[model samples]
Target: MNCTPIVRQHPDGQSINYYGVTLFDEQSSKSLKGIFTSWRNLFESAPNTFEITGNFVDWDNEQDGEYERININRDEVVNQLGKIISMSEHLAKGNCYLYHLGK
Candidate 1:
């Protein structure tokens, strides 16, 4: 498969280079870097398909703010949260560790 190079400006006005080497945006070239890695979470499947959520919570260690919060299980959430952070830093936005691809 052959792919043409695609360039677009990010929301921050920074230019991002994507050199397609496989098919469309499926693969990139040595000269360019893509928004997110194609491979991420391919084991645990979730509803949103992304491990991260939009729900914002200011984790202020200080007691001045909200004392505590509630969500999914603590241990489970902590584990999933770690994966989410690592994945988000790699992917652009839409995609996340919430969904799995394959084994």
Candidate 2:
């Protein structure tokens, strides 16, 4: 579950998961959604924030343009996604938060 550059241990004892490093546009949005459809509820349920310590966004309130999509090799993402999920489970406990920065 240890991935180089993806999960880096900070000096402050914080584990940084670089799952959102990929940037995607409108074109890949559909494809990305297709891959993540199964985890839609999990993602939509998690709390999200625009900044590190900003107000949380109401997932139900936002209609569109809420999150960014990823455009990458389909197979590559599939593999990385699995790794990230495992890492999350191993690293996180009760409530985990998702951070989103729109384009």
Candidate that scores best on lDDT: 2
Q: Model 1, range 1-103, lDDT digits (tens) per residue?
A: 2223233332332233333112212122321222222222332233333333443445655444442443334345446555644554443333322232222
| Candidate 1: segments with Cα more than 4 A from true spot | 1-72, 92-103
Please provide, for model 2 over 1-103, each residue's C-alpha lDDT reduced to its tens digit, 9 standing for 90 to 100: 2122221223332223344343333333334344444454344444442223333355657653244443334444455666545544433342333332322
Candidate 1: worst-modelled 10 consecutive residues by lDDT: 30-39
> Once superposed on the true structure, which residue ranges of model 2 sit more than 4 Å away at CA?
1-71, 93-103
Candidates in order have lDDT scores of: 0.33, 0.39
My TM-score estimates for the predictions, one after another, are 0.21, 0.24
In candidate 1, the residue pairs with backbone N, CA or C atoms under 3 Å apart (3 or more residues apart, or in different chains) clash, namely 49-99, 50-98, 51-98
lDDT (0-100) at residue 87 of candidate 1? 50
**Candidate 2 similarity to native, TM-score:** 0.24
